[model samples]
Target: MNYKVDPGLYALGHPDADSPVFISANFKMSFDHLRTSLNDGRSGWILVLDTDGINVWCAAGKGTFGTEELAKRIESSGLAGVVKHRTVIVPQLGAPGVSAREVQKRSGFKVVYGPVRAADLPDFLDAGMKAAPGMRIKTFETGERMSLVPVEIVHAVKNLVWVLPFVILLSGFSGRGAFLSHALQFGSVSVIGLLTAIAAGCVITPMLLPWLPGRAFSLKGVWPGIVCAALFLFVRDVLWGLHPAGALETFAWVLVIPAVSAYLAMNFTGCSTFTSLSGVKKEMKWAVPAQIAAVALGAVLWVTSIFV
Candidate 1:
């Protein structure tokens, strides 16, 4: 579904020309957040810029919530005629894309950066448009990190769906009869390994982000992948006495799980406040190739184990 609002100026609670004008991305969630934060009987004008349904921080990074868009939106929306004040409040997260000097130079409107979050807008407005130090600092707390997990899991599952069938079919390759039995035996262990990788990358990595060993998310994810692999192997071989995998398959999974986990954990770079666009790009350049190589090697070893 389309999750974007129309890009234009919207009035809230009978706002007049003198009311404060808040800048927002056209993503419905971003627009809604800004509007809801001002729901305490405060009237204002929201100028929504086209961000292609992306939130303020991401849109800013992508250059959609930028100076050119801000200037064009101001002119197109007839904002100057509607509002007497020459000031517009942009969200602090969007500061990366919007150059205040360039915006003012182009549109003749001063850009006042709002708080890091929309929830702080009321206090910022009440303080005569001055933000407290705490309001400016962006935080990536545990709750926010946890909130991003479900989407990651959804994406991981989507990728796994196409890959799982091929893996299951491969597990049955014994060059003999009884394909179903072999598939059930070896395939179940492979499925466990894949699921463990998903949990390591999508859940454990994000939850233990602060305490994780490395700065790069992919590297940080390795610890969880290793721990999950060890635990899964232990439960299967020792606790359950269900050692269906041979030596090669066991070693293959130990390599594959961490590689998959690292790749999946790298996806969280977009959702994290700790990484910059350049940093993400740099990490991906090396990490993607490494993850691919590891997974390919592991897959070869796993398939070879079935025949040998």
Candidate 2:
């Protein structure tokens, strides 16, 4: 099958009267994984609910994966006319947004809550299964932690471009050394620092999420960022030998790196099962201003070091 992970209704081979009907969110990755997991020659109907490109859980919380959307999509896809069964299996995490009673009332189709992970779908279908306690639970495993990095990197790069030129310009103003060399050096350091920051937020923090000593993602990210910055400084001093103005540059980065990384990690609240809107809002109120201050202060110090 030449299956592409599109965000719409797709029939996986020829679904028969006994074939199962699966529902998933419109997010490409989610849809793709669902289909890929079912590649063992099972025929089914995949009805993708439009969740505005968000995964099932987040979209469910936002009500994008609610009863109304499901009802509408079922009607538009002509699913009622095509399928012999009136049962649709939905991801368990989407339970918050969808009211099974309401969906049944509106569309005459009963909603069955499926396993938490897509990989369990085949077993789930074969056993004529109810959601096991394990299947109903969500866990952020190492693989899940790693997958978030690509999107975070993409977002960070866009922001980095805007900040890079200014960092380079400031490097020249910071010293009487060869301006071009200093600028280039500054750019390199800035990129390294930013990439480190992204890794701290998107990779390390999430992998160590349970072990990270904080209730907030910002705080969770800060621990790794600070550790990463300290290790970077130690290595730089030992290997490259610090320049006369290197201490100031290092100090600025220690503060700046963690702040940026923490802020970015905080954004991952949307992806997490632990975060609530009220909790995220509260964290942002404190974390955002603190990050801005740290970045501003770091910039000021770096510029001042040039004059001194």
Candidate 3:
């Protein structure tokens, strides 16, 4: 979706020099949210910062919404001439990147942090720019967590398009029945295993995030991966009446599924409010290599199972 707006000053509803100046990221969604919140007969000047189309929270973590950008945008946009008040209200989520003192020292404007949610902006402004305790708190409710699932599913499907065919082709090399027959039998099972891992990572893990055991996302995801693996084995060995897989193939999948799920779950850190930039970096340093090693070893074991 195209969600970028130009970075500059935008006037909302014929703002005057006495109107308040609000700071925001140039993302279309961020700008729209701010404007919509102020539509209740309030007038203001929105100074949109260049954040490369990212929303405020993420942009702040990446440093795109930092003090330098805010100061530069204020100067370049001639904000001092447009507003009589020297104060600019920045969203609370953008606080990570911005230093209020630094911005004031550089741009000659005082920075006032607004509420965590734009929906509360009207009340915050009417209450003499004071944020209630509730407005300062950020929550990752069920709806917010589930909203990120579709993006993960889309990414999994894209990767599967190529990996699935390769897996099926390799299945034909098993020294058993006719090539096509072996491919259909073994490859179908492999596909099911892959789908189960995807569901565990992209859906089940996120759905059970809060209750999942561990603060680290990778560790939390392992529980769901284990559950999905058991379910897949049940369907394959009992319900489908397919030939039971060899010990090597079964063991390989046990390692591979959890690793895949953990990696995908770790990616969710970027989309969630529960993690910080530093924390994510620390997690990836150990988690990524471990995941790679697990998947590689699993692949070798699976290939060896075919001939033996």
lDDT of every model, 2 decimals: 0.90, 0.81, 0.91
Clashing pairs in 3: none
Best candidate per TM-score, number? 1
Q: Model 1 over residues 193-307: C-alpha lDDT tens digits?
A: 8999999999999999999998999999889999998888777776435545578877888888999999988998887877887999998899999999999999899889888
Rank all candidate structures by their lDDT, best first, as comma-separated numbers. Answer: 3, 1, 2
Off by over 4 Å in 1: 174-177, 237-241, 281-286
TM per prediction: 0.92, 0.85, 0.90
The runs of at least 3 residues in candidate 3 whose Cα sits more than 4 Å from the true structure, single-residue gaps closed, are 238-240, 277-290
Lowest lDDT sum, 10 consecutive residues, model 3, at 234-243
* Tens digit per residue, CA lDDT, model 3, 1-308: 78899999999998999999999998999999999999998899999999999999989989999999999999999999888889999999999999999999999999999999999999999999999999999999889899999999999878888888878988998766699987888888888898889999989988899999988899888899988887887788886577787889888889889989998899888777779779888888999999999999999999898878
* Residues 177-245 of candidate 2: C-alpha lDDT, one tens digit per residue: 688886777556656777787778777887888899989899998999998887766665555444633
Off by over 4 Å in 2: 1-14, 26-28, 50-54, 76-78, 238-247
